[model samples]
Target: MNFKFHHIGIVVNSIEQYEKQMLPNKKVREVIDKIQNSKLALYENFNESYIELIEPLNENSTSFNSLKKFGNHLNHLCYKVGPFSELENFMRDRKWIKVFGPVPAALFENQKVVFYLNRNSQLIEFIISE
Candidate 1:
Protein backbone atom coordinates (compact mmCIF):
# COMPACT_ATOMS: atom_id res chain seq x y z
CA MET A 1 0.00 0.00 0.00
CA ASN A 2 1.31 3.41 -0.96
CA PHE A 3 0.14 6.80 0.26
CA LYS A 4 0.40 10.30 -1.12
CA PHE A 5 -1.12 13.70 -0.63
CA HIS A 6 -3.56 13.63 -3.53
CA HIS A 7 -5.34 16.95 -3.19
CA ILE A 8 -6.73 19.60 -0.94
CA GLY A 9 -10.48 20.03 -1.11
CA ILE A 10 -11.70 23.57 -0.79
CA VAL A 11 -15.28 24.02 0.26
CA VAL A 12 -17.08 26.74 -1.64
CA ASN A 13 -20.68 27.90 -1.77
CA SER A 14 -20.62 28.17 -5.51
CA ILE A 15 -17.98 26.59 -7.78
CA GLU A 16 -18.95 29.16 -10.41
CA GLN A 17 -18.01 32.05 -8.16
CA TYR A 18 -14.60 30.63 -7.32
CA GLU A 19 -13.77 29.71 -10.91
CA LYS A 20 -14.74 33.15 -12.17
CA GLN A 21 -12.80 34.96 -9.45
CA MET A 22 -9.81 32.63 -9.12
CA LEU A 23 -9.56 30.90 -12.48
CA PRO A 24 -10.95 33.23 -15.12
CA ASN A 25 -9.08 31.83 -18.09
CA LYS A 26 -11.35 30.52 -20.84
CA LYS A 27 -9.10 27.51 -21.37
CA VAL A 28 -9.68 26.30 -17.81
CA ARG A 29 -13.35 25.57 -18.35
CA GLU A 30 -12.58 21.89 -18.80
CA VAL A 31 -11.11 21.83 -15.34
CA ILE A 32 -14.37 23.21 -14.00
CA ASP A 33 -16.35 20.51 -15.79
CA LYS A 34 -14.04 17.80 -14.49
CA ILE A 35 -14.79 18.99 -10.99
CA GLN A 36 -18.56 19.39 -11.47
CA ASN A 37 -18.96 16.06 -13.18
CA SER A 38 -16.11 14.07 -11.70
CA LYS A 39 -15.66 15.64 -8.25
CA LEU A 40 -12.03 16.35 -8.94
CA ALA A 41 -10.07 19.17 -10.58
CA LEU A 42 -6.50 19.16 -11.68
CA TYR A 43 -4.08 21.92 -10.86
CA GLU A 44 -2.31 23.82 -13.66
CA ASN A 45 0.80 21.73 -13.32
CA PHE A 46 -0.72 18.41 -14.26
CA ASN A 47 2.14 16.49 -12.76
CA GLU A 48 0.75 17.14 -9.32
CA SER A 49 -2.60 15.63 -8.34
CA TYR A 50 -5.32 18.28 -7.97
CA ILE A 51 -7.23 20.73 -5.78
CA GLU A 52 -10.79 19.51 -5.59
CA LEU A 53 -13.22 22.40 -5.15
CA ILE A 54 -16.50 21.07 -3.87
CA GLU A 55 -19.94 22.62 -3.50
CA PRO A 56 -23.16 21.14 -2.20
CA LEU A 57 -24.83 19.03 -4.82
CA ASN A 58 -27.34 17.48 -2.45
CA GLU A 59 -29.17 18.04 0.82
CA ASN A 60 -26.87 15.63 2.65
CA SER A 61 -23.72 17.56 1.83
CA THR A 62 -21.97 19.17 4.80
CA SER A 63 -19.87 21.44 2.60
CA PHE A 64 -22.93 23.68 2.16
CA ASN A 65 -22.81 24.79 5.79
CA SER A 66 -19.07 25.16 5.73
CA LEU A 67 -19.36 27.38 2.67
CA LYS A 68 -22.12 29.45 4.28
CA LYS A 69 -20.02 30.07 7.37
CA PHE A 70 -16.52 30.31 5.94
CA GLY A 71 -17.34 31.83 2.52
CA ASN A 72 -15.03 29.64 0.40
CA HIS A 73 -11.73 28.64 1.92
CA LEU A 74 -9.66 25.62 2.68
CA ASN A 75 -11.89 23.01 4.18
CA HIS A 76 -10.30 19.58 4.24
CA LEU A 77 -6.89 18.05 3.86
CA CYS A 78 -6.90 14.73 1.98
CA TYR A 79 -4.43 11.93 1.53
CA LYS A 80 -4.57 8.93 -0.71
CA VAL A 81 -4.39 5.58 0.97
CA GLY A 82 -5.14 1.93 0.35
CA PRO A 83 -7.45 -0.52 2.21
CA PHE A 84 -9.84 2.12 3.55
CA SER A 85 -11.37 -0.15 6.19
CA GLU A 86 -8.08 -0.53 8.01
CA LEU A 87 -7.75 3.24 8.28
CA GLU A 88 -11.41 3.62 9.13
CA ASN A 89 -11.28 1.11 11.92
CA PHE A 90 -8.14 2.74 13.23
CA MET A 91 -9.91 6.05 13.46
CA ARG A 92 -13.04 4.50 14.92
CA ASP A 93 -11.09 2.70 17.60
CA ARG A 94 -9.47 5.98 18.51
CA LYS A 95 -13.00 7.35 18.96
CA TRP A 96 -13.02 9.77 16.04
CA ILE A 97 -16.44 10.41 14.53
CA LYS A 98 -17.30 9.21 11.05
CA VAL A 99 -19.50 11.94 9.69
CA PHE A 100 -20.18 11.28 6.02
CA GLY A 101 -19.41 7.93 4.48
CA PRO A 102 -17.91 4.51 4.49
CA VAL A 103 -20.14 3.77 1.56
CA PRO A 104 -18.34 0.66 0.25
CA ALA A 105 -18.56 2.16 -3.24
CA ALA A 106 -17.31 5.41 -4.71
CA LEU A 107 -18.72 8.16 -6.86
CA PHE A 108 -15.56 9.20 -8.67
CA GLU A 109 -13.03 6.81 -10.09
CA ASN A 110 -12.56 3.60 -8.13
CA GLN A 111 -11.81 5.54 -4.98
CA LYS A 112 -13.58 5.45 -1.63
CA VAL A 113 -12.87 8.40 0.59
CA VAL A 114 -14.52 8.59 3.97
CA PHE A 115 -15.24 11.93 5.61
CA TYR A 116 -14.66 12.27 9.32
CA LEU A 117 -15.62 15.15 11.62
CA ASN A 118 -13.36 15.13 14.62
CA ARG A 119 -13.54 16.88 17.95
CA ASN A 120 -10.29 18.68 17.18
CA SER A 121 -12.23 21.08 14.94
CA GLN A 122 -11.14 19.83 11.56
CA LEU A 123 -12.50 17.76 8.72
CA ILE A 124 -10.30 14.91 7.53
CA GLU A 125 -10.72 12.33 4.85
CA PHE A 126 -8.96 9.14 3.76
CA ILE A 127 -8.97 8.07 0.14
CA ILE A 128 -8.47 4.60 -1.26
CA SER A 129 -8.22 4.31 -5.00
CA GLU A 130 -8.92 1.16 -6.89
Candidate 2:
Protein backbone atom coordinates (compact mmCIF):
# COMPACT_ATOMS: atom_id res chain seq x y z
CA MET A 1 0.00 0.00 0.00
CA ASN A 2 2.92 2.34 0.79
CA PHE A 3 0.63 4.54 2.83
CA LYS A 4 2.29 7.30 4.81
CA PHE A 5 0.48 8.99 7.66
CA HIS A 6 -0.39 12.42 6.34
CA HIS A 7 -2.65 14.57 8.42
CA ILE A 8 -5.45 14.88 10.90
CA GLY A 9 -8.30 17.04 9.64
CA ILE A 10 -10.20 19.21 12.06
CA VAL A 11 -13.36 21.23 11.54
CA VAL A 12 -13.37 24.71 12.98
CA ASN A 13 -15.70 27.71 13.29
CA SER A 14 -13.19 30.35 12.25
CA ILE A 15 -10.01 30.05 10.19
CA GLU A 16 -8.64 33.45 11.05
CA GLN A 17 -8.91 32.85 14.79
CA TYR A 18 -7.58 29.35 14.49
CA GLU A 19 -4.68 30.52 12.38
CA LYS A 20 -3.82 33.21 14.87
CA GLN A 21 -3.96 30.79 17.78
CA MET A 22 -2.21 27.83 16.19
CA LEU A 23 -0.10 28.89 13.24
CA PRO A 24 2.42 30.87 15.24
CA ASN A 25 3.77 28.33 17.72
CA LYS A 26 7.12 28.14 15.85
CA LYS A 27 7.01 24.36 15.54
CA VAL A 28 4.60 23.73 12.72
CA ARG A 29 5.08 24.40 9.03
CA GLU A 30 2.19 25.89 7.13
CA VAL A 31 2.01 24.24 3.73
CA ILE A 32 -1.20 25.86 2.61
CA ASP A 33 -3.14 28.77 3.94
CA LYS A 34 -6.00 29.18 1.53
CA ILE A 35 -9.65 30.09 1.41
CA GLN A 36 -10.84 27.73 -1.27
CA ASN A 37 -14.43 28.97 -1.56
CA SER A 38 -17.38 30.37 0.32
CA LYS A 39 -17.78 26.92 1.79
CA LEU A 40 -14.23 26.20 2.89
CA ALA A 41 -10.88 27.44 4.09
CA LEU A 42 -7.99 24.99 4.29
CA TYR A 43 -5.00 25.46 6.56
CA GLU A 44 -2.37 22.75 6.60
CA ASN A 45 0.25 22.56 9.30
CA PHE A 46 3.20 20.25 9.41
CA ASN A 47 4.94 19.58 12.68
CA GLU A 48 6.03 16.07 11.86
CA SER A 49 3.23 14.99 9.57
CA TYR A 50 0.31 17.35 9.07
CA ILE A 51 -2.78 18.86 10.63
CA GLU A 52 -5.47 20.38 8.48
CA LEU A 53 -7.90 22.96 9.80
CA ILE A 54 -11.09 23.27 7.82
CA GLU A 55 -13.19 26.28 8.60
CA PRO A 56 -16.74 26.58 7.35
CA LEU A 57 -18.00 29.66 5.57
CA ASN A 58 -21.70 28.82 5.86
CA GLU A 59 -24.25 26.42 7.30
CA ASN A 60 -24.32 24.52 4.04
CA SER A 61 -20.61 23.71 4.20
CA THR A 62 -19.32 20.29 5.22
CA SER A 63 -17.27 21.80 8.02
CA PHE A 64 -20.27 23.67 9.43
CA ASN A 65 -22.46 20.59 9.17
CA SER A 66 -19.79 18.47 10.82
CA LEU A 67 -19.07 21.02 13.54
CA LYS A 68 -22.81 21.31 14.19
CA LYS A 69 -23.10 17.55 14.55
CA PHE A 70 -19.78 16.72 16.17
CA GLY A 71 -18.70 20.04 17.68
CA ASN A 72 -15.46 21.04 16.01
CA HIS A 73 -13.66 17.75 16.31
CA LEU A 74 -11.33 15.54 14.38
CA ASN A 75 -13.00 15.06 11.03
CA HIS A 76 -10.75 12.65 9.17
CA LEU A 77 -7.29 11.08 8.96
CA CYS A 78 -5.48 11.31 5.66
CA TYR A 79 -2.74 9.10 4.30
CA LYS A 80 -0.52 9.82 1.32
CA VAL A 81 -0.84 6.92 -1.02
CA GLY A 82 0.07 5.70 -4.47
CA PRO A 83 -1.96 6.09 -7.63
CA PHE A 84 -5.75 6.25 -7.33
CA SER A 85 -6.46 3.05 -9.22
CA GLU A 86 -4.14 0.88 -7.15
CA LEU A 87 -5.35 2.27 -3.85
CA GLU A 88 -9.00 1.98 -4.95
CA ASN A 89 -8.48 -1.66 -5.78
CA PHE A 90 -6.56 -2.21 -2.57
CA MET A 91 -9.30 -0.72 -0.44
CA ARG A 92 -12.04 -2.51 -2.33
CA ASP A 93 -10.24 -5.80 -2.01
CA ARG A 94 -9.90 -5.24 1.71
CA LYS A 95 -13.62 -4.37 1.90
CA TRP A 96 -13.05 -0.92 3.37
CA ILE A 97 -15.79 0.51 1.11
CA LYS A 98 -15.28 3.91 -0.46
CA VAL A 99 -17.46 6.63 0.99
CA PHE A 100 -16.03 9.59 -0.89
CA GLY A 101 -13.88 10.42 -3.86
CA PRO A 102 -11.26 9.45 -6.33
CA VAL A 103 -11.71 13.01 -7.44
CA PRO A 104 -9.60 16.07 -8.08
CA ALA A 105 -8.33 17.49 -4.79
CA ALA A 106 -7.58 21.02 -3.66
CA LEU A 107 -4.42 20.04 -1.79
CA PHE A 108 -2.02 20.53 -4.64
CA GLU A 109 -2.12 21.27 -8.31
CA ASN A 110 -3.63 18.24 -10.07
CA GLN A 111 -3.73 16.17 -6.91
CA LYS A 112 -6.35 13.41 -6.64
CA VAL A 113 -7.74 12.01 -3.44
CA VAL A 114 -10.28 9.58 -2.02
CA PHE A 115 -11.98 8.53 1.19
CA TYR A 116 -12.73 5.09 2.52
CA LEU A 117 -14.90 4.42 5.54
CA ASN A 118 -14.15 1.29 7.46
CA ARG A 119 -16.59 -0.75 9.55
CA ASN A 120 -15.89 1.50 12.51
CA SER A 121 -16.92 4.60 10.52
CA GLN A 122 -13.32 5.76 10.80
CA LEU A 123 -12.35 7.65 7.68
CA ILE A 124 -9.23 6.93 5.69
CA GLU A 125 -8.33 9.65 3.24
CA PHE A 126 -5.96 8.74 0.42
CA ILE A 127 -4.10 11.41 -1.47
CA ILE A 128 -2.45 10.83 -4.80
CA SER A 129 -0.27 13.84 -5.35
CA GLU A 130 0.75 14.48 -8.90
State which candidate has the highest TM-score.
2
Show model 1 residue runs off by greater than 4 Å. 23-47, 58-60, 104-107
Candidate 1, residue 20: lDDT: 72
Q: Could you tell me which residue pairs clash in candidate 1? A: none
Candidate 2 residues lying further than 4 Å off, grouped into runs, are 23-48
lDDT of 1 by residue, 25-127 (tens): 3322223222223233434424455566676665455565666777779988767777876777777787888886654323344356677877787888767
Return the lDDT, model 2, position 21: 69
After aligning candidate 2 to the native by TM-score, how far in Å is the CA of 94 from where it should be? Answer: 2.2
lDDT of 1: 0.61
lDDT minimum window of 10 residues, candidate 1 = 27-36
Pick out the ten consecutive residues of candidate 2 with the lowest summed lDDT: 29-38
In candidate 1 the C-alpha lDDT for residue 116 amounts to 81
Count backbone clashes in candidate 2: 0
Each prediction's Cα lDDT score? 0.61, 0.67
Best by lDDT: 2
Candidate 1's TM-score: 0.68
